[model samples]
Target: MNKILIIDDDHGYRDVVSIAARKKNWEAYTSPTWRNVQHQIAEKKFSLIIADYRLRNETIIELLDYMKREKFSFQ
Candidate 1:
């Protein structure tokens, strides 16, 4: 199964994405905070990561930089 990670502070948005992913037979995981998302990344391998451009605690650019430093690959 394909695993996907959805990162956003908006609960509704996460739910919507999760539901859509499930309909397509993909496993969806969500995180409301950057720290939580980071932990999730460390714990599992996701085929895709969909993140909000502006999170409550971090911007997308900052998150991308961190991911690069940590050697996390995402399309």
Candidate 2:
């Protein structure tokens, strides 16, 4: 089974994408903020990540940096 994480400040967007992913038989997780996203990433191994390019003021660069620093990878 594949696991997918969707990060977005918009609940509706996350809900829609997560629903679509779940319909495909994939496990879907969602986080509304960068802090929570990081927590989830540290707690779980995700096969894929779908995120908003810009979440409030924080950009995806922070997430990329965190991933690199932690050696996080898709599985």
Candidate 3:
């Protein structure tokens, strides 16, 4: 099954996305903060990552740069 990661602080949004993904038979995971999210990314491979453009901890650009520096291949 396809795996997906949904990064957002909003619980409602996460729930909605998770439910949607489940309907499509995809494995869905969520992380509310960047600190915890990094471990998830390192531990698993995701087919898609849906993140909020503005996180409470960092902006999307910062997150992208961190992913690039860590060599986390999303593509």
Candidate 4:
């Protein structure tokens, strides 16, 4: 099963992606809170990430940088 991490502050956006992933039978997890999202990512392996270009706390580039710095990889 493909594990997908969706990072978005917008509830509607998250729901839309989650519903789409569900239709494809993929396991999708949503991250509304940035802090908790980090913990979740650290604890699990996600095949892909769907993030908003702009977030309340940071931009997508910064998020990608953080993931890189942490040596997180996707398959």
Candidate 5:
């Protein structure tokens, strides 16, 4: 099964996306903290990444920065 990474601060969004991802037979992982995102990406590869524009401690800008530094590919 394909895996998806959801980077968002809202629980509601995560839950809704998780349900949809599961229904489509994909594994969904969510993270609200920036630190966890690093670890998760390091440990597993995700086929897709859906991120919110804003997060608790950082914005999507920082997310882009991290992705560039880590060379993570997202669809």
Candidate 6:
């Protein structure tokens, strides 16, 4: 199963994605807290990431930076 990470501050959106990922047999992890999300990425390896265009504490740029630094590709 592929691992997918979703970073969003919306509960409803997270739940919907979680359900969809499960249906596809993908492991999904979500966080409304940006700090936690970043920390998790450092410790876990995810095949794909689905981040919201906006976040409460961190912007898309921050996420993009992490992705770039980690050499994560769209594939």
Which candidate number maximizes lDDT? Answer: 2
Give the per-residue lDDT of model 2 (tens digit) for 3-35: 999999999999999999999999999988666
- How do the residues 1-75 of candidate 1 rate in per-residue lDDT, one tens digit apiece? 889999899999999999999999998998887677677776677899888899886787887888788898643
Give the Cα lDDT of each candidate. Answer: 0.85, 0.89, 0.85, 0.84, 0.82, 0.81
* Regions of model 5 farther than 4 Å from truth: none
Instruction: Give the per-residue lDDT digits (tens) of candidate 4, residues 1-75.
Output: 998989899999999999999899899999865555887787788888888888887788877777888998776
Residue ranges of candidate 4 with Cα displaced over 4 Å: none
lDDT of 5 by residue, 1-75 (tens): 799988888889899999999999999998876567787776787898888887887787886788788887743
Ranking by TM-score: 2, 3, 1, 4, 5, 6
lDDT minimum window of 10 residues, candidate 3: 33-42
Candidate 3 lDDT over 1-75, as tens digits, reads 889998899999999999999999999998886667788787778899888888897777877888888889753
Pairs in clash, predicted candidate 5:
none
Candidate 6 lDDT for residue 40: 71
lDDT for model 3: 0.85
Better of 3 and 5 by lDDT: 3
Better of 5 and 6 by TM-score: 5
Give, for candidate 6, the lowest lDDT window spanning 10 residues: 66-75
My TM-score estimates for the predictions, one after another, are 0.86, 0.91, 0.88, 0.86, 0.84, 0.80
Error of 3 at 24 (Å): 0.6
Flag the better candidate by lDDT, 4 or 6: 4
Q: Tell me the deviation in Å of residue 37 in model 6.
A: 1.8
Winning candidate number (TM-score): 2
For TM-score, candidate 3 versus 5, the one ahead is 3
Q: In lDDT terms, how accurate is model 6? A: 0.81
